[model samples]
Target: MRVKRYIVNALPEAVSMIRTDLGKDAVILETKEIKVGGFMGMFRKKRMEVIAAVESGASKQGGTELPQRKPSPEVNAVVEQILQTAQRSSAAAAVMEPPAQPDPPVSDKRMEREQFIINEIRDLREYMVKLSRQQSDLHALSEPMLALKERLQEQELDSEWIDKLIEALSESEKSADRVYDRVELWGEAKHMLEEWLQPYNNAEISRDARVVHFVGPTGVGKTTTIAKLAAEQTIKRGRNVGFITSDTYRIAAVDQLRTYANILNVPLEVVFSPMDLPKAYKGLSDRDLILMDTAGRNFRSELHVSEVISLLQSNEPNETVLVLSLTGKTADMAIIAERFSKYGIQKVLFTKLDETTVYGAIMNLILKYGLHPTYLASGQNVPDDIERFKAGKYVELLLGDAEHE
Candidate 1:
């Protein structure tokens, strides 16, 4: 795919520019309103910024061509009749002009305008309904497609993913039988889901990495997730694990990590400044694994994110795990991920899974950002609540089955 961006005064102008540059086959990926030519945020002109993409070989092939259809004799007769009727109506209106009278009440005029708009909207809706009915047979697989879309919406999947799935299924359905049973349709959907999720199946954290840092907004259970992984390394893998916390902003964040360190019999170092990070790492140099926890703040603020980045900069070859809460809004998750992306985030860690049933955000994040999730923390059960991420089991849960062990 080849992507390009265009900034224009209006959406239509942007579309025209995209067609001229990327051809008619170009797909609009994103669009947003932006301010330009403003001094200190005053008197700025609002403009539209559009991101468009086309297939790599689209230009060579002259883009996608529309199929030509010759109009039938009956259709041409109908069109000619409609044009003649419109011409007659226009001539009649022009010839029969009524004498001007006093203007009607302003309220009556307003009501008539409002009623006209309402009628136009109603007519448009009815026309669209008729059009859909006419094309229903062409879209014979719409039943299964609608069912899949409804299920995905109930699962709270992102619209982008749901639309992509529907598009893919629609293409596949064209070759299938005219009718489909619910079981067969569901089997096909499951197979498609598995294929879509296959790329995210590998979520294992590298054992060779010695330093792991967890960063995210407040109340995402970063410290607890680190503790869970720490326990897994120390007890299950028999690797020496140590704790380092730069989360002094929260009242009990340091103490919380310190408690976990005490329980695991590992050294805990609390650093107040970025300069203290080197000292803290030196203190835990002998350990096989060092887990670092940074203070959670409003990631929307660039200053706060920069502060966290400064602390993590000292730890070379460190894996930054961005912790996200499933209970939070997906829109917020997108913003958090975008802001924290400056830190070179390598892996994602989802927490509080037991608190919510929806798992679409997990898949959305993985697919959208290409971030591999290493662990999933379902509850607050110290080490027991966390588990390695498995794509197949995750998809099963999304399909409304209980999580498999």
Candidate 2:
């Protein structure tokens, strides 16, 4: 980068100088107002100081090379003296009466030349003052912005989201410390994340909905998540709940959910095929809330995803909850969500939160697929480990600092 500084009186003059010296590609880096040319601080004149930069190899007009230059101490002193004298002369002229006799032609020409120089100096001063104010507005955000970027990267946030966050944070005013206050920065970041996540933050499980199906790829904790929700409905909410498993492909999954059914004292129905779904639903007809657990399959197979969807079709108007693990790769989650989209999956439940510290995948999947996440399963604990998704709490979790009692 080739950086240059200009001290001038007006914004337009500084801009013109930058364009002339550094080319149109020059970027304004910083600017601030400074006082120059004062005697005993009584005649202090305000000017702008601008810091601009251009990338190396940027093309300059006229195919000419200009040597890099810095304002020397003597040059600055001379400029200050000239500005002070011009200001005094201007002030004196404004107050004093004109001479009784007209000046001679030669002297008038000299005076006009001097007046032109003074006008140029005044314009330079105005340019500097404008540049200074612009730079001051940005200066307060510099440190805080750097800190915020580092924090977002440390959290493994997406680059696009990070850029947006930094832009938003930059537009706001900084605190008196002139640095990003950790708590305040996090609060703003959380708010921004929550807004991006708001449309997908929905995890509501309708109480009146008879059947809620949990479906996803293998080993994503589908059966356990169902057990957690079932327990919540039956034990805590005082509502009658039943379990229907189309997951007979794994006897282990069947046995595990059976254990949960026994503990909760709820009925469990096992469907051997899609044809058996109607009978299972009938068996749980009296239940207020019926939670269905579907077999986790290789969702990449069109046939397998179709099979799951067909089984879900046996129970129409049912809520399909796609169970995804936080530990899974984002690419796989997206594919799984797309494959299951045919089943009309409306809600998503994320499991294995305790397995990974990075939670960007959750937000990414929800935003990408436009799906609502209804529950978060942090651990293996059947009921206690699951909670309804709260956008604020989830944002805090992603931002990394939860207050402890």
Best by lDDT: 2
Model 1, C-alpha of 142: deviation from truth (Å):
4.2
Question: For candidate 1, lDDT tens digit of each residue in 161-185?
Answer: 8878766766666677354455565
Q: How many times do residue backbones clash in model 1? A: 0
lDDT of 2 by residue, 1-405 (tens): 999989997655675677678766666655556899989888999997867777899886421222123333422333464455546555555446455566623346446645665666566555555555545544545654666666666656666777677777666544333445666777777788888877766558876577888888889999888888888887788999999988877759899999999998999999989788888888988888888899989998888988888877644456778889988887788788888776667688899988987777777667667788888888888789998898898877777752220
Whole-model Cα lDDT per candidate?
0.73, 0.74
Clashes of each: 0, 17
